[model samples]
Target chain A: MFDTSTFIRLLPELILLVTALVVIFVDLYARRRTALGLLPGLSIVGLALSFLAVFAQWGTREVVAQTLAADTFAAFFKMVAAVAVILVVLASVRYMRARTRYVGEFYAFLLVATLAVYIAVSARDLITLYLGLETLSIVSYVLTGFLRDDKRSNEAAIKYFLYGAVASAIMLYGFSLLYGVTGTTDLQEIARRLLNGDVLVNMEWLAWPAIVLVTVGFAFKASLVPFHQWAPDAYEGAPTPVTMFLSTVSKATGFAVMARMFLVAMPALQSSWTALLYGLAVLTMTLGNLIALRQTSVKRMLAYSSIAHAGFILMGLVAVTTALGQPFNGLDGVLMYVVAYAFTNAGAFAVVAAVEDGTGGATLDHFAGLVGRAPFLAAAMLIFLLSLAGVPPLAGFAAKLFVFAPVVRQEYYVLAVVALINAVLAAGYYLKVVKQMFFVEEPERAPFAVARSMRWALWLMIIAVFGVGIFMNWFAFMASQGAAGMLGL
Target chain B: MVPLSWYLTVAALLFVLGLYGVLSRRNAVAILMGVELMLNAVNINLIAFWRYTRPDNVAGLVFAIIVLTVAAAEAAVGLALFIALYRLRETVNVDEIDLLKG
Candidate 1:
């Protein structure tokens, strides 16, 4: 049953897994040899190869009988995940080497984490989706605690684990309920059954609870409000590079799976879930922004800010239906917003990682007169913060435009107003960081040398931020193809 | 032959009880136990649904087994994290694990 054609389809995953194993073994020996750089070099080669593998599999909807999705929707996220992971590996080279001894395992786990994202975005079956999410979750747990000697790292891992375990279990129960009602694990089959009405004769009431429960699970993963208790702590305590991965790649997995499940399996019950997300969007945006206002720790501030961004992304999902042109469906806005935000937030976190490296912490005190100490780092951070605040000529601007346009067009006037207000409130804190860097009274501190790899990662993020924004046409087209693949059903 | 609701009822009770333990427990290990119970409840529900509804298909059975296996993995990882925490701070009581805060 396992044919060569299936092998061709799964080429990217195969290459990543093989790279992970090779890194682990080579690192085991490299440790005794003190050859610190080989694993990252090998990992990047694997990532570059998978980039080609994913490209090879493009426009694959015509492919028959594959377990995972071959559509542009999944393909788009695979691209995003690859970009994020590559940036993270580039940046973490020196930082991680300074902190831990298991450098090879770190690189290996990072590769496996990327494979998890590939599985998740491509999942068409409930069981496969569960596997993808759990794989990412477990990998994240290990990565968060990788600094075994640090008490804070241990605390963060336990908090993340406790929250993650219960959430996934609840989500599993939700999946079981859906399975009981539909009697099929395939998402399309479940949709067909749900829409048939006869299949739901008396079990119709179960659908609502199932949706609510399933959402609880994904919401926790996505770190939406009320279920977001662990995010700030975990982000604040985990090593900064892992924090970057968590906020960008891992969070994207949550939205990818959420969008697929709702848009594909449960569009028949659109009104119910949309309404649910609407309330979550408001609460998440307002609370995430408000609390971010108080965090002195820059890392915790970014954590809450990421949660706020999740709310902004949810608005795109809420306003799913639109007369906006092809691929301009609410989901495409979510996709474009995500693609843009990935670069911007990553750049922001990369700067934070650098500052932490120099100052031994990431608080306002560390940032004071940053321009005098590290003019280039401060300037790059300023651009990232501006982009995040939706200033024009940056990726965050394009992201906000794509998402907000849909909500305005849908005439969700209240949600639009709330989101707009939150945007302003969010700007207040972003500028606070800017103010610390530029307006402080501290004397010039000596500049610290950022590793070459870290500099390269920052440059890539900054360019992508500008590139995605100014060249919005190309990314919009890619996102349009992705959304079309999903809803063309 | 037992009715389906009997299994579902037992599962729901177990789930709620586990949730209670998770909410109220201070010891990290006890909380892990609570999470294990919740996962077990999910397993029971999956098996009962499979047994009663579609005995012909293996989807339900397969899902239950996957959950069982993953749950063990989750517990193992959780325990490892707890042990690391215990060694660092000399206590695994979550209430005392307060180094990271607002």
Candidate 2:
């Protein structure tokens, strides 16, 4: 059951698992406050190394033990997860230091959670997939409530846990139905059986229910509409760094898993699910943007905006339609969108974390006249906000271009038009934040200093946003290659 | 010999009842218990399917075992969250834990 090739294939995950264990041990011994600095340092080193391991495995494709698959698609998302976690840890150094005492578990769980995402995206078996999802969910619940003293944090964690448990239970029930119908937990095997009509002839009616039930779990994870109530509360209540991770890395994982499940395992049921996703996509974007228009708190507004972005990404999936073994451009668009979004959303939340550190407020008024106090931060936030609004020459605009191009190419005019309206609605809210930071004036407090690690993280995110924006052709090509590899095209 | 449909019917009823409990209950612990009931229903479905359809294969059995293990872990985390909520707000009522809104 075990072999050397499997170990080699999982080198990145192995390094992360080892690093997580070491962080726990390090935390236990480093009781002094000064020694706490080493934890985040070690965590970053671990993440960077894990990133290198993934890079080394590029272009390698193999399935380990009929459960985990190592391929470029998994490698691409591993890099995204690693980069997001590194940025979150860097941003967290000062934020967590200022708020809580359990610094070690915070860093350790970050590594563990990153590892879980790797497992999740690579899973080819239902058992492995479920375990990876639960691991990510559990670690996230703890991380959300890291500040035990904060009532908001505690309440957020409770809500997240309650919602998470029920969602997972429902998903498990779906898995059971699927397993019963197919008689195997291997995803590809199930696909083979369903495609060859070995299973469907006897159980055709069960397929739609199974697909709908499975979508419920994924929709919850991705914060799709009607299943998205927990997002704003969890995002607003959690620590800003955790909020950054949740919006970017956590959401990216959901999309990654959703793409894999739909494109790889259940291609037989594509027509029905794509139609379902079309309706969900329209509702998610409209509701997410319209509600964000009324939010007073900047954090809560970003939370809703993240939901709207989820809708944008979902648009790519809804447009996917393959024939004659040719790969769908919609999947390529989705892959690019996920990478671009990881940087943009994380960068936006990092700015919020820095501002929260400077002033203990999170409302729109807190950002007034920000340009005067911190020009670099305000400039960076401006770029991120513009990018999010899909302004030209930014990552968000590039991402939106890639996603909508395929929908238009496929002659999906109605989806394209609805998306255009949603884009305009999204810009309205994002521009309001820009107006507060640049135009509105409040000159009462002294200029504040951003922490060293936070500054470095912000610069890295700024570079990524521009780099992806300017080199759109190169990144799009890479994303398409990864998407093609996923489909074995 | 019992038919497969009977087991599925009972499990579906249990799952529906659990879902109703989860949606209607206000107390956090009670909601967690509802989640537990839902998981148990899943376990029954898994075992029943395994015995009737795939008696020669071990995948279904292993899946049920994993589900049981994961459900316990989920309960532990849920209870810990409830205890944390109690310590913060002096009550485990989910409705009262609304420090965040709109």
Cα error, residue A42 of model 2, in Å, equals 0.8
- DockQ for each of the predicted structures, in order? 0.81, 0.82
lDDT of 1 by residue, A1-489 (tens): 578887888888899999999998897766544548688889999998997898777777733354588788888899899889999999899899889988899989999999999998889988989999999999999999999899888889999999999899889889988988888888988899898874534666888889999999989988999899999999988989999999999998899999999988997899999999999999999999999999998889999999999999999999887343544568888999899889999889999999999888899889999998888899999999999999988999989988998888788999999999999999999999999999996875676777899999999999999999999988888887888787773
lDDT of each: 0.89, 0.89
* lDDT of model 2 at position A92: 96
Model 1 chain A poorest ten-residue lDDT run? A321-330
Ten-residue segment with the worst summed lDDT in candidate 2 chain A? A319-328
Over the stretch A324-343, how does candidate 2's per-residue lDDT look in tens digits?
44434888888889988899
Model 1 gets an lDDT of: 0.89
C-alpha RMSD values across all candidates: 1.4, 1.3
The candidate that wins on lDDT is 1
Candidate 2, lDDT over the whole model: 0.89
Summarize candidate 2's per-residue lDDT along B2-102 as a digit string, tens digits: 98889989999999999999999999899988999999899999999899988999998999999999888878877887787777778998888878998
